[model samples]
Target: MEISWLGHSCFQLRGKNVNLITDPFTPQQESAEPPATLSKINASIITISHNHPGHNYVQGVGGNPRVVRGPGEYEINEVLITGVASYHDDEHGKSHGRNTIYVIHMDDLVICHLGDLGHALKEEQLEAVADADVLLVPISGGKSVTATQAAEIISQVEPHVVIPMHYHPTPDEQRPAQLDKFFREMGVEAIEPQPKFTVTKNSLPATMQVVLLTPR
Candidate 1:
């Protein structure tokens, strides 16, 4: 599988010769990053974890993607997408609307997008997270979990790889910090990957680690 970060919580993952994008927000809005145009492809699966301005702008993501409103399970196009229910805002799932987290499992990899997740997991939620090869998280403060909470989830899920998102304030965004605090809390050497990252089943590590993607 190959992955590209399209700023904020939007990540484009290519697997099974197709693409999957998560939580797309319009750059004109409160978004800090602009969309990455990979003209070669359209998003096959678009997962919306929440309805926030930063998490759900159909236009910014571009193309006609089969949007998945998650918190449950669906299998299509040789990919299994399981949506785990969560809270959209802070206040322990009390604010905004219900948040959805997606788990994309394919031939060689399992990817988890914790879209604007506001709180930690219960035992069942932790069980769902444990299956991921890569865990995509929100590191910025506010409604989403803090660096401390994210660090705890990482400990519980123990994924082979972690992709931190939802921090990083570009000149365009008004947010405070980026993924640095989350990295320090996790106590791992963060790798600033090329705009895109490729992985095969054979290359997965047995232990968990954090990977910070360089935005396009």
Candidate 2:
């Protein structure tokens, strides 16, 4: 499968038979980073984490995708997806509303997208995403989980590949630090960024590693 980050929490996971996108953000949203254009997005399935404008803009995509919202089990175009209910804030969505965590089975690999997840996983959530091959996590320190919290969560999940998202990559005066804070928490000074990530079930490593993708 090929995974491409389109800025913020949006990602396109492409397989041989199916293509899926996660949390398509609006262009005008504050979280939208440079080159975060939605006109180029085309997917067979689109997953919305919540009703927030930053994540629920389905019209931006052109492929007439089957949009999946909230918690449910769905099989679209041979891809199996399980959406687990989560929250946008740590206080059970009281502050930022509810979110959905999607675990997708594609190309014999289990890919988990933790949509705007604001807190550490509960026992049930952990069970839902157990043994994930690739984990898409929000590591920004603003509305989502902080860098330290994200590192702890990564430890608990122990996914084979962890991809950090929803960060301020552009030069924003308010939140200038991009992935630096998260990298610090992970005890890494630098990691070479890749344009996209491609992996197969056989290519997965035995141990966990962090991959920083340059949004395209």
lDDT of each: 0.76, 0.87
Global fold similarity of model 1 (TM-score): 0.87
The runs of at least 3 residues in candidate 2 whose Cα sits more than 4 Å from the true structure, single-residue gaps closed, are: 29-36, 171-178
- Which candidate has the top score in lDDT? 2
Summarize candidate 1's per-residue lDDT along 116-174 as a digit string, tens digits. Answer: 88888878878887888998988786778889898888888888988888876567633
- In the range 1-216, model 2's lDDT, one tens digit per residue, is 999998889999999988898998777755434233677767899999888877888878878899999899999998999999988899999999898999999999999999999899999999999979999999876678888899998999889999999886665433336577888888876787798999999999887788988877
Q: What is the lDDT of candidate 2?
A: 0.87
- Shift in Å, residue 179, candidate 1: 2.6
**TM-score of candidate 2 to 2 decimals:** 0.92
Q: Which stretches of candidate 1 lie over 4 Å from their true place?
A: 29-41, 90-92, 169-178
C-alpha RMSD (angstroms) for model 1: 3.5
Best by TM-score: 2
